[model samples]
Target: MRTLIRGMLEFLRMTVLLLFFMGIIGQLENSVVKMIIGREGYDGFRFGGNFMFLIGDLLLFMVFYRNYLQFRGWYTEEAERLPKRVTRMMLGFGFACILLPITIALIL
Candidate 1:
C-alpha cells in the first residue's frame, strides 16, 4: 500500500540521517583527540574538521525535526486508519537510533 511504502521511505531517510550524524560526530571526536595528542602542530586542520562536524550536526538536527513534524502531520491526517505495524516500525527505528550508536561507540 502507499502508506507502507511511504513509511519505508521515511525510515530509510531517517536512518541515513542518523548515519550521517554519527559519522560526523565520530570524525570530529577523532580529529580532536588526535590534535590533543599532537599538541598545537595541526591547529588549522583542527578547525576545518570541527567546523564540518558542526555543520553536519546542525543539518542533522534540522532534518530530524522536520521528519518529526512530518510524521506528526501524517499521523494526524490518518489517525483513524493508521496501521499498527507502522507504529511498531517507528518505535523500532527510534530504539535503534538510540541504541545502535551507543553500542558502536562502546565497541569501537
Candidate 2:
C-alpha cells in the first residue's frame, strides 16, 4: 500500500501537466466545434465534454505504454514502474466518471 502511494506521488507531477494540456486541447476542440456549429449546448461539444474525450485518449495511451514497457522488460528496477499500476486504476476511475457520462450523452 505504501508503495502504491509512493508510486502515485511520483507520478502525480506528469499527470497534472498532462491534465492541464488535455484541458487546453479540450477547450480548443470545443471552440472549433462551437465555431463550426455556431452554437453551444448538447448539440455541440463543450469544454468539459471535450476534456473527457481527451482524457480518454490519454488513458488509452497510458495503458498501451504501460503494457509495452512491461512486455519489453526495459526497466532496471521493476519497483520504479509501480506507478503505472496506480495510473491504470486512475484511468479506470476517470473513465467511470468522465467517459461514462460522455457515452450516455452520445447514446441519449
Candidate 3:
C-alpha cells in the first residue's frame, strides 16, 4: 500500500512537471515572436517559433504521459531495480517543464 501511494505520487509529480514544461515552451515561443516582431517588422518569425513550440510541447506531453501510464500502478520489482537516478531525472524533467514557461514569461 505504501508503494502504491508512492507510485501514484510520482506519476502526479511527473504529469505536473510535463505541463509546466509545456508552459515554458509557450513562453519561449512568445518571446521569440516578440523579439522578431520588434526587430524585423515581420510576422513570420512568430508563426514559425510558435509552430516549433507546439511540436515540442506535444512531444514532451506524449513522453510524459507514457511514463505516467507506465508507472501509474504499484511499483513492480522491476521498477524497484531501476536506478534511483532514473527517477530523479524524471523528477528533474518535470521541474524543468514547470520552470521553463515561467522563466520565459518573465524574461519576455
The pairs that clash in candidate 2 are none
Q: What lDDT does the true structure give each of the candidates?
A: 0.51, 0.56, 0.54
Write the residue-wise lDDT of candidate 2 on 1-108 in tens digits: 766765675467446655775767567655654555455533543446655665665765566445544344323246234376687696786566455534555554
Which model is ahead, 1 or 3, in terms of TM-score? Answer: 3
TM-score of each: 0.38, 0.38, 0.41
- Error at 31, model 3, angstroms: 0.6
List model 1 lDDT by residue over 26-105, tens digit each: 67656654554543322434224444544545544544545454555432344243255655555455545433433443
**Can you give the lDDT of residue 25 in candidate 2?**
51
TM-score top scorer: 3
lDDT by residue (32-72, candidate 3, tens digit) is 64664444312343324444445556655655555554455
The pairs that clash in candidate 1 are none
Q: Which stretches of candidate 2 lie over 4 Å from their true place?
A: 1-9, 41-56, 59-108
